[model samples]
Target: MPVATPVFDLSHIYKLSPETEDLRVYEKGQIIIEEDNGKLFPPSMTPDMGIGTCLLNERPREWRCNRANVNGAVGAVVIAIQFYRHHNYIANELHELNPCWDDERLYYTARDINIAVFTQIYFYELLPILLGKENMIKHGIISDSDGFRDMYDEDVLPQMTDEYHYALRWFHVIQEADIKMYDNDGYYLNTIPMVNVSLRTGFLPHDENLEKMTQGSFRQYGGGFDHIIDNDVSNKTVSHRLNKIRIKYSCINLT
Candidate 1:
């Protein structure tokens, strides 16, 4: 089903409410991260929000972040973790540059920079690969030159249409099922079924899983943009059963 996309705000990072944001914050403008058996992991969700459906029976807590447990795929979780770390790293750097700045100033500044970094990656790096750079430039979706392009209109509210939301589902055709793991040295490690990692964030902190998965996220090839849909994506990932039913009904109506 099509859903509305809001403006390019990093709600996923800062969360929707002051209470949730407070829970994730550590002292000195850092997000709360825990050290478990010498490896760093996101702070554990208290009271168990029931999102970690695939988590091991022994592991009751999911990673504490606004959206980390939403899908809980290893790739998604790792990226969240990276941004959490990056935010703190930036906060620390800002403190060093301006020692007089208070925690609030440092935190907000770092958050702004983090959002900007994400925007840069989306526009300059990811979009060019997905939609040909030339096409994006031609459509004015992105600027062709390094100079600033003032396309913003105060009257126009940034909103994503239902059609645009539905169109994004096409990327599922390229969703990879097997998440390959590699070491920092680029040595191939074992592959994990992407299904196994869904909602099973507890798996990331153990046995160098986080580090290996981080390596693989950048190194592994995405599923080919071909006719075949990955079985795990079709059968196991969250919401697949409902999606299957939707597809079935749509086909029946069409036929």
Candidate 2:
């Protein structure tokens, strides 16, 4: 059975990140939950800059939003995990906060903390491979000919037979880690709702001229209004405190 694409009326309240192209797959209006066509979709996220920590434990809550997977391409899957909510435009809150340059506009808004918690794990896994002597060859992080394929092949993708390779370019790892930290510490503080959007479809149109839709695996983010902190000297010192959190909770969860 072909699952029809869901739609939201798209009000002026919703806020998109890139705002231009297919960078975002969302709809605004009423709350809608659709079956994911029964696919085993893995939720992934790449956060850049925040508390510099991962695996945030927060209260349970619900988020509502629309999602889709456009015509697929190689690595077309965007691992954009998020949380969302919908509401009417806010003419008052707009007047209240008085607004700022970096502020996001929306009366009732959806909130998201990309899967920063997960990406940290991936980065940690690469640490040993990156610092290992034999792993570091002539060019750079060889990453097996398939860009960490040897690490993921056996357990993750069973259908893949061809062995390919690519290095995790130095830029991606650094930038990705930075993004993860930002979300972890509430760098972008207009905390909204949370949902897990997964694009498990392949990177290309099927050989049969078909494309698979994305399965959104929603996860509740925070349930409090506390993530938003008052502007203060300490509040602006998230980066300097990263090491402190690292030292404090570094081993808290190891056991």
What TM-score would every model get versus the actual structure? 0.78, 0.21
Per-residue lDDT tens digits of candidate 2, residues 1-255? 111211111211122233512322233322222323332222212233221112222212211122332212112233321222112123223434554412233222322111222333333354544466355543353343434332334353222122211122222222211111122323432221111111112211222111212111111121222332222211222222123422211121132
Stretches of candidate 1 exceeding 4 Å from the true structure: 1-7, 17-21, 24-27, 48-70, 147-158, 236-255
What are the per-residue Cα lDDT tens digits for candidate 1 across 56-169? 323443343333333344555677667767887899898889889877788888887887787778787898998999999999888888765566577965566766655556
C-alpha lDDT (0 to 100) for residue 108 of candidate 1: 84
Residue 15 displacement in candidate 1 (angstroms): 1.9
lDDT agreement with native, every candidate? 0.64, 0.24
Name the lDDT of candidate 2.
Answer: 0.24
lDDT leader:
1
TM-score of candidate 2 versus the correct structure, residues matched by position = 0.21
